[model samples]
Each structure stands twice: as structure tokens, then as C-alpha cells.
Target: MSAIALRGPERVVIHQHRRALWSAGALALMGVAVVVAAWLWASSASDTFAGSGCSVENTVRGCGDTVRAFLDTELRFSRAVDYAGLAMMVLPACVGMFVAGPLVGRELESGTYQTSWSQSVSPARWLAARLAVPAVLTLAGVSVLSAFSAWAWSRAKGTYYPRGDWYEREVYGAMGTAPVGYALCVLALGALAGLLLRRTVAAMVVTVLAYVPLVMVLNRVREDLWPTARFLGGDRPGGDAWPVDSGMLTASGRAIRLKDCSGGAGDTAACMRDRGGVTAFADYHPASHFWPLQLVETGILLALAALAVALAFRVLRRRHG
Candidate 1:
């Protein structure tokens, strides 16, 4: 019985993908955990941000700033997930990568591609169904997580890049739904690697090596295009600079000051004001570069996915011959 309508072995590949469904569910659960943590964080930090704990004794940055602009506002869904949502949005990629790698690569390693190779369906159709079904699931899971993140971040957009701490935007902007795109790209790479190496574990290793660089490059590429943020010493504490993207300065031309330590406020303490740069330089305005960077980042990831698909088809054609 010659059939190309995904009747026989193609269903098996799709089922293999489905067998990994628990990982996707776990990703969804992780999203819930992120939301809960955000609620707890906002609740506890609300009082502190609202002028309750403006002291040199506090360990948190901007503690003495006496700024609660966002805190005064109610916590809404948009604000809760927007920036913090990146954590959830990105979690699925890890799940998707590990899941995608084994779906067909394992079969190929076991010489199952041969069974399908002997069929009328062709390697192309086999790969297509295998990649498409799970990628769709990955996308759906990501969509939910991103929606939550966007809504949450929107609520507290004011806190996107709070003063003296530019890490928020860096984290949220670079780390958000961007990972979803990376996951799809990784899946494509997995399909290609599974096709080429024909070994599940080896293909996974290749996928990891290939995808990690792409992911890291995706983030750095965002910074590079935006003329704004950049990696600060490989995601660790050290000598690396991330240019601050404090929105455009007020029309009043009033310079926002970076305060200095008088040493009397304690060695670990700092007092900042919106006055001038007598103490230090004010944050750079990243407003101009933000979206440009985002677009660049998104484009790069999609490009990687496209390249993988293109190569997958090419390799499948070769295998067909």
C-alpha cells in the first residue's frame, strides 16, 4: 500500500512528537510558577518601592530612590507578565529543543528512515510532518506564555528600565518571547541534524552546539543592531558594558543626575537624583534603538529557521535519490 498522505510511518513520527507532550505541559506549569513568583515579588517590593524602605541598609538597588511611580498603580495582567514573562516565554525552548531532537533522529539512528525510505511518501514528506506538528505545538505553548508576558510587562511598562538599574530592559527585552523563535529554529536544526547525522544522541549534541551559538548570537545581534544594549561579560559578573536606554530626556532639558556617595551614607549606599551628572553620567536614551534591535533579533532567528528548513529539504532530496 503506497500512501503519501501521512498514513503509515509519518504518523509514527508525529506520535513520537506527541509522546513528549509532558515536556510541553511542564513548560505551561512553569509559566504559572513565573506568574506566581511575579505576584509575590511585586507584592513585597510594592511597599519598598513606595517609599517604605528607602534606606542605605536595604540590599536592593534603587532602594533609597523614594520612587514608587509604578507601585502606586495597581498590578494588572499586562504589567505582571510583560518583562517578567520572558522567563516563561523562554522556558519552552529548552523543552522544545530536547523534545525535537529525539523525535526523528532516534528513528534514523535505528535505521527506521530506511523503512520510510522504501515508501512512496518520500523523505521530504516524512520530515515535513515530523517538524510541522511539534513546531506547531511549541508555537502554541509559546503564544500563551508571551501573551501573558506582554500583558504583564505592559502594566508596568513604567518600570521597564527603572533608574540606576538598566538590567530590567536588558533581561526582559533580550530574554522574552525571543526564545520562542529560537525554539522553532532549533527544531528545524534538529530535523536537519537528524537527517544528516542519522544518530539521535549525536544529532542532539549537534543541535545543542548549533542552537546555543544561534541563541547567544541572536541576543547579541539585537544589541549590535540597536546601538543600545550589549552583553556584559558573557551573562556573568565582570567587565562588560550594557548601554542604558533611558527614554528620551524631558523637553525641559533638565538633566537627570547620577548621585554620588558621600561615604557617610555607608560604603555600600548610594543617593541618586534627577538633577545632573555631577555625581556620574545619566542613562543613555535607548528609545531610538529598542525596536530596531528587536526587529533585527526577530529577523535573525526567523532567518536561521528558514535556513534550516531549506537545508532539510535539500538533504531530504539527496536522501531520496
Candidate 2:
């Protein structure tokens, strides 16, 4: 809470936004509470089948009711966690809009930032202070929420109620450093938008517009961030693997489009054989590629953030200096 490492401009920034900071803290605390409560509820529910030797795949004859009850309870918990994950995903855009509108654009639009610059504070220093204070607070808050979210996910995932996967869009970002990367990226983008637009509402809208497309692109290309494992013939990846592509392989090792033979499907297998498709092929990323994918995507986001930060500073200098 104390801006001891921060000097005049930074401390002033913190003071100016004290209420918003406190509200953010309160919200983070509420998120933690929800995650903890749901985790406890799910854990207690899991105990019902501890020694009953009952599972979702294989249920004992008399344990059906008990298993159903546990699944129902776990389903609620799963929903809570999934919702939290979704919130985490949306948080970056929220942060971006706030930074663009009230934090930077309002001051710029009202010409209040000039007052600070006249007080022996360089424009670069003022902007740096604005970025630094929020960056630190945002990083700390998001890291905590993501950690708790990941903990909650670990408890209910792979359970009978709401089956989850690591590669799932809602589950992936919240469970790793990707959220932090996204937040920082959007924060920088927001600042840049604020500086460029110099209008509160315009900056906010532009920030969100920019952020949404970036997220969509990243999500679409996420699987290609790392190398995929290939399986051929009867070999196949595990159930938990993230499938990238699949098709049939010809005898000459050429890949064939499975859809091409779908026109006359008297026997699909026979059609494949006629087309010289001797084996099935698949490309996927196993569970082991989780960290690699996370790291690579995070690295890309951080790189974009750094670029935006540079551009923001450059724009500020050109306009103010």
C-alpha cells in the first residue's frame, strides 16, 4: 500500500487514485473468498466417494445416488471456478479501459497533466510514474487472483461434474502467467490509446477495440506457438492431448484429406483403402506442452507490451517536449 520506492510523481498518482485502488483490493479479496469457498465445498463433496470405490466411469450398484449427489455438488463448484476463470480472462480488457479513460485520458483531456509538468516534473517522468504505480498494483492483484483461481481449478478439474481440460480457452489463461502478460500488455496499450486520443471515452473505446482483436488472434494461434507431436498408424495421443490436425496418410507418405472421400461413404474405411490411405495421422500437443505454450504466448504478449510502452513514451515526448 505504501509507495516507499516511488517519489513525488508516483506518490501523487497513488494518492489521486486511492479510492479506486482500495475498491480494486476489495474486489480481489472477494474473488479470493469465492475461490476458497468453492474449493472447500468441492473437497467435502469428493469425500463422499472416498472408500465407496465409485467413479464417474465405473459406479457401484448401490452408490448411484451418492455419486449423483457428489457430482451435483461438484458441478456447482466447477461452475464457480469456471466463472472465475472467465473473469480473469476479461480483467485485462477492464484494466485497459480504466487506464485509458479515467487514469490517463481524463487528465490529458482536461489539461491537468500540464500542471504537473510545470512543477519541475518532466513529461516522461510523469508518464512513467503513471505507468509504474498502476503496473505494480495490477501485477500484484492479478497474480494473487490467478493463483487462487488455479488452485480452485485443480480441485474440480477432471471431476465428473464439469469436465475440464488444460487446453480449454477459459481454463488456460487463468491457470498460468498468461493473465499477467495479458494485463501488462493491455495496460500499455491503454496508455498509448489515451495519449493518442486525448479524449476519455474515445480512448476507452479504442483500448477495448484494440485489446479484443489481440486476444482473439492469440487464442486462435495459441496451438502453433510450440511444436506438435505427430502420431501415425495405430499410435495416438492421449485423451488429454490437444489435437491440432488429423487426416489419413497415403502409402507413399503423402497426406490425404479425409473429406475428399466423404462423398461416397458406403464404407469409409474401404474408401480410404481405395485411395491408398494406409494409416491415420494426427498432430497434437500433449499435457507436457502446457508450460511451453504458456511461456511462448506470454513472451509474445510481453514483447508487444514493451513495444507499446516505447511508443507511448515516444508519443508523450513528441507532444509535450
Candidate 3:
């Protein structure tokens, strides 16, 4: 097969990792089953309350048992959805560790990569195939999980459980392309780490260490990626909005944090009036900002992934050639 087609290397990589691939597929299917079952359970439980005319907000004397049952089921479903989101959040780290340790690092550590290189498979081709196969599999799996997560979030959101906001850290990562971007980025980073360290355990540890801080920094700055809407005076964003900043506005229109003004005798309003504060203000990203933020973060991660892939290939060529 031609190098451009990558058919030969692709086959070799797939065959080598077939066991791991099957295991990953089984896990993905199990996740789908869990999500489906949880949704069904919640929906069925909801029927009891629906027929009784008792919602979470409106509970009558005779509807106690029905409400309790509905709440129990809804809480379970909510926990399932949350756990799924947490899994999606953790998947990139798992992918990175696997790519670093078993995929690339183990071969290089054991000198097996040389065998592949000697068999007319150039170093570049070998690395590309290694990256491509896992990338495709990870993408497919994450996309499927993300779709279901989004579905689950939509179904139970804004109901009794108010924990599934789109902007929330776990929900945000699981429901959109951001998780895919993060996985791809970590995958490339793992390959690069493996190439640079040339040790399975070392590369895995480094990938995890590097990824943790990267995610932390991204989460810290995520709200600033897009411009926030400003609301002055009595106007405020809806409950679903992600509040970025809130403070009191001075008479001259300068924004000062509420914490800066000390409440005299515990009277915050009196303190605010004494400090030239005219009105309260808030800055937030409404629900419409979800797509824009997701796109921006995903774009940044993709660029980083491309950079990591280039670095990995460059390192491989420099050392081998």
C-alpha cells in the first residue's frame, strides 16, 4: 500500500492493539446502555407524578409517596448523568496515559519500533499510523458519548435537578466538541512525550502531570474566552447564565467589587451609598454563549494538538534518521 494511503501501517497498528480496541468498544457500549436505562427509569418515574398532578414544586398531601418515588428516580438519573460527564472529563487523561505508555512508549522502550522501521515503514509513517488509529477510535467513542450526554442533559435539565447547566465544568466538557478537542490534544501530547522520554512509565507520568495543569489553566480562563454581557441597575441575566463578574458601580461609572466596600454596622446598602456606589452590576455569559465558547476552546485545543503532532514527528525523525 502507498504511504499516502497508510493502509499497511494502519493494519499493523490495528492488529497490534486489537485487544485494547475491543475492550474500549465494550466499555463504550456499556456506557450507552447505562445512559439509556437511566433515561428510561427517570421517564417512567416521571409518569407517576405526571398522572398525580404533583411536581417537585407543587406537592400535595396525598402525593407524598408518589413525589418521593419520582424524586428518588430523578436523583438516580441525575447522578448517572453526572457520573457520565465526569467520565468524559477524565477520558482524555486516560487516553493520554494509554497512548504514552502502551501505544508508543512500550514499543520504543522495548526496541520493537525499530522492527517496524526496518520493514520499509519510515519512522514518520509509523508514528502517523500510531497517532491516526487511536485518534479515530477516540473521536468515535467520545462523539457517541457526547451525543448521549447532551441528550441526557436536555431531558432532565431545568427540572427538579438544577445541576446540569451547559456552562458547568463537567457538563460543558461532555456535551460538546470540547471533549474531542481535549482528547486529540492529549493524544498528540502523549505521543510527543513518549518520543521525547522513550520510557513507558516516565512518559505516562509526564503526560498526566502536563495534562492536569493544562486543564486547570483552561478552566480558570474559560470564562474570559468570550465577551460577557453587562447588566446594570435592576437588570440581570437569567438563572442559566454563567456569571463571570459582579460588583457595584460607582457614580462615575467605574466598577468596584462589592467586597471592596465594608458594610458599616453590617448595613451593606448604607455602606454602598456612603462609598459613591450608584447601582449594582453584573457580567455574565448567557446560554447563547455556549457555542461560541465551545468553538473557541476547541479551536485552541486543535491548534495545540497539531503543534504536538508536528513536534512528535520532528523528534522521531531527528533521533532515528
Candidate 4:
């Protein structure tokens, strides 16, 4: 039949991916640079710790003045990583926005998609190539950043550089496999948004707006993914434990928040007792739960990404078929 075409999706992918590949190459190089920098900084920080003769047994409070200074010095590197880590955390969203706008949106905006369709590249295959090239690149770049971020944080886990608890949103987003998840999800969503919006700037804006809230929502619900260990009484959990909620349980079995147990007069403990606060308990996740939380979130994000990709395909089929 004359309806049959000459060029396949392979050529369509190659043509669509040339400039995208260049950008991906640039991002890959930047990821490599970040990894090298993180390794060097970690090595220096390790040396600083070794020079101070501080072992894992030495808590932050237990360190001597010399050791404290060394830790502070080590923290400079951690702080750098922290700042860079925020960017890495957001990088996937940024990449998705770019993919949505110039990469995917421009073709739709400028009618180049018709050229591809005319060349025997079906809309589905063209869209698949449009999404796939950037997906691979997004994974590569963000995976490197995620690995380095995880390593850097691991190097500083017991230290004070993290500035807050391990469950902190920024810290959690950058470390582990979560960033890769964010990247893939964002990219897929970007593709779907671009396909729906059919305008470059609009697609970019929509992708970004959609991405930020998803991240925040995931962060908020992440702790609930698995059961946290419950601690009661004066027995403190290990320093690596991240407390999700802490409160006082009254003799009446009512939960009183820790903030509400302020002892105004003399002994705080006595005042707490007077307020019917019998025992205090905390729910926390230990360091061992890091991967579990990370992987669970990753799984959720990946599923969302798959859904978005499927939606993109459906939209393409409906629009072009």
C-alpha cells in the first residue's frame, strides 16, 4: 500500500534526540563533576575527622575542642553539599520543565510533529522517542547526583551538617534513590503536560507547578510509608533515630503533646505529672529505615510516572489517530 512509510521511529528518535543528547551530555558531565567534587570533599572531611582522632564512638557532644573545630571544618564541606544538594533535588524538576518546553513542546507548538507523522513516524512512536531519550538522560544525570548526595550525607550522617533531623524534606529529597524517582516522574509528567498544553511556555509552567506539589506531598507522607519504632519513658533511642511524633500519654490514656506539658512553676517532671501526663513516648525511624523510606517513595513516584507516560500515549493516540 502507498500508505506504508519509509523511515521508522528509529530515525525519528535520532532526529529528535540530537540536540537533546547534547544537553544530556552536558548534564552528564556536570553530574560527573559533582561526583568527583563530592568524593574529594568527603576525602578531605574524612582526613579532618581522622586528624582529630574522633571515632564513631565520639558523639558530637563528646568531642573535645580540637575535635569540635575539626568537625566544624568538616561541616563546611557538608554545608556546601547541602546547598548543592538542594539544587540537585530540584534539578529533576528543572530538567522536566526544559524537556516539556523546548524539547517536546516546541515541536507541537511549531507543527514539526506533522512533519514526523508525514514521514511515517506514528504519533505514538514519535512521542515515545520524545519521552524516552530524555528519560534515559534524566535517569543518568539524576542517578549520579542522587548517589553523590547519598554518599555525602552518609559521610555526615552523625554530624551536625545536616542542620536538622534526617527526615527533613530537603535532605530526604536529595539523598538515596528518591531523586531518580523524582526525575523520572517529573519527566513523564512533563511529557504529558506538554502534550496536553501544546504550548511551550504553558507546558513548562504547568510541569513545574505540578512537580513541586508532588514532591512536597510525597515528602509529607513519606514517614507514613512504614511503621516507626515506639519509644517510651526515659530510654532514649539512638542518635540516628528520626522522631516522627513525640507526646506524653496521660493516666487517662489521653495523648498530650510535649508542648502542652510545659511546667510553669517548679519541677517540670512534677508539673507534667500534675497535668495527668504519665509517660512520654516517641515514634521514630532509625537509620536502618532510610532505604525503606527511600525505596517506597521511589516506587510510588515510579508508578505515577508510568501512569503519566500512559496518559501521554493516550493523548497522542486520541489527538493524532
Candidate 5:
């Protein structure tokens, strides 16, 4: 009945840390809102530019910048998929590295895990409550944010697929399906790191500098090294198409509108400009294998995270014992 103790189902030990919960929730919302607003503003600018009176041949500054950013925002992405990738890939990773920023590290710092473990509640449950509540909220926020990103990018002329050039880096996938799993895993990692490191700052730093990078960078590096490998998902973006089958240059290429970005056919279409759509370009090229590729790759990563988290539980129990 004190600040450090709570009774609940052994499976889910949820303590009421209203302050931490509120803070996490607020931070998550703000992070996602920033992406949403950036996308919307970009989308609106793109739309306005798409419709504005400015002609490319005209001698006026006109909607040049507006049109560029607008088309850049959505072009070739869905709201959910876009946001999902960002949330899952970037946000959750950051938060997951930090979720334990308050959870395990703080407990160890205050030496509360010691007191709590002495109670009937096992070390597992203590970490569970601390991790579970925040993990759930963080994953939920990730899902919402990803959904919006996908929507915002749906109208993009060229989409997020990289055809050629350096612009293909923007087209990432949705965080909803895969990100939830990742977020949970990240929470677990946070707890494990916090417990092991016994310092929230160190845990956070390690999570970001070590674990998150390890997970995130592999795909990128593999894409660069053995792009044709199926397991690596290659440089073909998020889909499973053979690069030979793709008429475009490579996955590393920036996104380019096949048509004029202004909606007309001729020279100077947005597609011709060769802007990178999204990182790892997952959208565009209708009916291609990108959809399946995105789903499968996301599944693999999330599963890895799940496994990591499960292992962390064991480690927590061991340490607690």
C-alpha cells in the first residue's frame, strides 16, 4: 500500500505510476504529433503547389519550394505504413531505449527493486508492471503515428520508392503491425538494460548506442552488402521483387515521379527530379512485391525483438533471484 508496492495478477503486474504514465504518454503524443504535422503541412504544400498557377517555365519564384516539399511529403506512401515505419523504426527504438529511463534504472537507483523483490511479488512481476504499462502506451502511440504517416504519403505522385539517384531513402513502411512488437521488445530491453546497468542514463545510452543501432543498422548494411539476398531484403526497397525485374535503377535510388510532379507529362515531372522517397523505400511501383516484402521484413524484426524481450525476462528473474 506504499509508493513501492502493488498487488496484481502475476501475469501482468501493473502498478499505478500516474506521473510516469502521464509523462510518457505526453512525450509520445508530442513526438508523433510532430511527424503528423510535418507530413500534413508538406502534403498541403504539395497539393497547393500541384494546383497553383506557377508554371515551371515561368520566370517567377512561384510555388517552386512549396511544390517541391509537398510532393516530397506524401508522394507514394500510405498514412499508416509511413507513420508505422517512422514510429517502429525510429520512435519506438528511441523510447524503448528510454522506457526504462524511469522503470528499472530508477528502481535500482532508489534500491526499490530490492525491497519489492523481498515481497511476494517476484522480480519478474516488478519489471513487468513497470515495463508493461509504458510499453503498451508507447506501442499504441507508435501505431497511431504510423497510420498517419502512411495516409499523408498516399497522394505523392512518385510515391516513396527509389527509382534512381539518392532520394530513395525516405520511403519506409508502417510501424503499426511491426512497431507494436518492436515497442514491446524495446520496453523489455530498457528494463533489462536498466537492471543490468543500474543507471537509467547508461541504460538509455546503451540502448540507443548499442542495441538499437545493432538492430536498425543490420538491414541497412545488408542492403548495401548483399542486396540480392532474400533474407537481407536487398536494395529493392521493402518488396520481394528481383532487382532485374524492376525497371528502376536500385533501392538506393531516390524517389522520382514517373510523370511530371505537376500532373502533366513532359520534361520536369516530379518523377524526373529524382528525389529520395523514404529511407528503405517501401511504397510505390503498383502491384510489385513491396507490400509482401514490408510485411515479412517487419515480422522478422518484431519477432527478434519479442525473443529479446523474453530473454530479458529470464535475465531479470535471474538477477532478482
Candidate 6:
């Protein structure tokens, strides 16, 4: 008897690709439209600044109320862009759930993977195909969106309005190579969860529940990943510093919260001195540290993603080998 021809994982890839084409295309169009709108808005804001002779370098100088109102309008619009960009930052988490749930979980739960296994497709190859296609697409799409977001943010941040800052959590997630790393990590996480749970609803729930804590931990630890600089005896060093911690140093060399000395007897400075405070200090990351922080965070997230992917393959091999 002749043996049946087996295309193995190719069939799985092709099937999934066809299913995702329209959704992926729609997402891509939406991303492009958002970026174009931000760029145009930024351009118009720039023209407003130029017309008023009020560059970021000289925003302090008097510009008429008309110019100020226009600039304020621009700031408000930039805040809207910020909201959209932040939503994009969480796109990976959404992708991760989809990957784990309907993509892999449903197949496993419904015993469809068995059909593929019955063919010449090894469990490992099937799982690999499941992970790779969506991963590639997610990486490409998220990276472009992150770059566009960063560009628009840079243009808007130069305004005199205080509506945004780099250290803001959502802004940080939206701005750099970090979002790419995040997307990859979540996709792997979703894949692993699906493989372990082997149930569509459970895997979907686990992915959603797990992603929030993971993001929170990352944010809490991010500023500490690199050594922060201590600024002493000054107002903040400059415009582009992220103040992580601030306090007054006691004469006995203990640090006390800045607020501890506020609203005390006599003047604030005198009150601080009486409380054994000798100097003020701030531990912070300067604007120059932006890329360093971003690269370090990206490295950490990608490492986590690699670990998740490795474990997922191991789990598949153990379960099916």
C-alpha cells in the first residue's frame, strides 16, 4: 500500500496564515493610519511653534495668547496620541492570549493536534510552526509602531506644556525597542501557558492574569537595572532627569524623606538643619541614560522570552515524546 504524503508543519502554518491574513492586514492599516495622523499633528504643532518664534529652546519667552492657546491645543492632542500609543504597548499581551487560546489551546483541547500528529508532523515541529509565524509578524508590526510612536513623542515632548514625560510608565512602554521585547515575551508566555493548560478557556485566563504582574514587576525593577546617579546640592540637574528617589542627608549620615522636613517650624531649610539634615540628594537617571535603560530592559525581556520559549518546547517534548 502506498503511504500518505505528509506536508507536516507546513499545513499548520498555511492554515493559520490564511486565517490570520485579514485580521493582520486590518491591524497593520490601523497602525499606519494612527502613525500618519500623529505625524501630521506634530507637523502642524511645529508650524505653530515656528510661527510664534517659540521653539522648545525659548518657550519661556513671551508668545501671544493665540500662540499659547494653539500650543495648549497641540499638547491636548499629543495627550490623545499618548493614550493610543499606550494601548499599542499592551498589544503583545492581547496577541499572547490569542496565541495561547484560540490558536494552540483550542486545537489541543479539541484534540485536533492529534490529527496533525497522526501525519508525519512531529509534535515539536507543529509547536514551532505555531510559535514562529505569529511571532515574526508581531515583531515586525510592533517594532514599526514603536519607532513611529517614539518619533511622534519626541516631536510633541518639545512643547512647553507639561502633559508628558519619558519616565511615565505608559510612555516608556510605547517608546523604544522595549515594546518589541515585550511582544515577544508575551507571545512565548502565551504559548507556554496553552501547552501546559491544554484548555482554551483556562489558558486564556492564565495568560491575562499572568501578564499584569509580569508588567508591574518589570516596571518596578526597570529604574534599578542600571546604577542611578546621585545629584547633590541643587535644584534638579536639568530638564531631562528622572528622579527615582529624593531625600535629605542627616549630619549623622541617615537619609530622611524630603517631606519630613516640609511644613516644619521656622523655614524649611532651618527645619531640615535642626532635624540633623546636612544636605539634600536625589538619585536619578538622566536623559543620557535613556538608551541604556531601554537596551537593558529590552535585554531582560528578550531573555525572559527565550526562557519561556525553551520551556514551552521542553514541555511539548516531554508531553508528546
Please tell me which predicted candidate would have the highest TM-score against the true structure: 3
Report how far off residue 206 is in candidate 5 (Å).
1.5
- Expressed as tens digits, the lDDT of each residue in 145-194 for candidate 2 is 87877778777765666546889888898878899999999999999999
Clash totals for all candidate models = 15, 0, 0, 0, 43, 0
- For all candidates in order, the CA lDDT equals 0.56, 0.86, 0.86, 0.76, 0.54, 0.78
RMSD of 5: 11.6
TM per model?
Answer: 0.60, 0.89, 0.90, 0.78, 0.59, 0.81
Residue range 71-105, candidate 4, lDDT tens digits: 66666666766776778777878878977887788
- Between candidates 2 and 5, name the one with more favorable TM-score: 2
Looking at model 5, which ten-residue stretch has the lowest summed lDDT?
Answer: 160-169
Query: Which candidate do you rate higher for TM-score, 1 or 3?
Result: 3
On residues 153-270, what C-alpha lDDT tens digit does candidate 5 reach at each position? 4533344432221113344434235455556556667766777788878888776765556555644542333233221222544432333222222356644333324456654422
**Rank by TM-score, descending?**
3, 2, 6, 4, 1, 5
In the range 190-295, model 6's lDDT, one tens digit per residue, is 9999999999989988988888888899899999988999888857667878998777788777877667767656676667667787888888998888889999
Residue-level lDDT for 257 in candidate 5: 32
lDDT of 3 by residue, 213-316 (tens): 88998999999999999888766787689988777788798877666655536776557667787898989999999989999999999999999999998898
Which sections of candidate 6 miss by over 4 Å? 1-11, 41-76, 159-163, 250-275
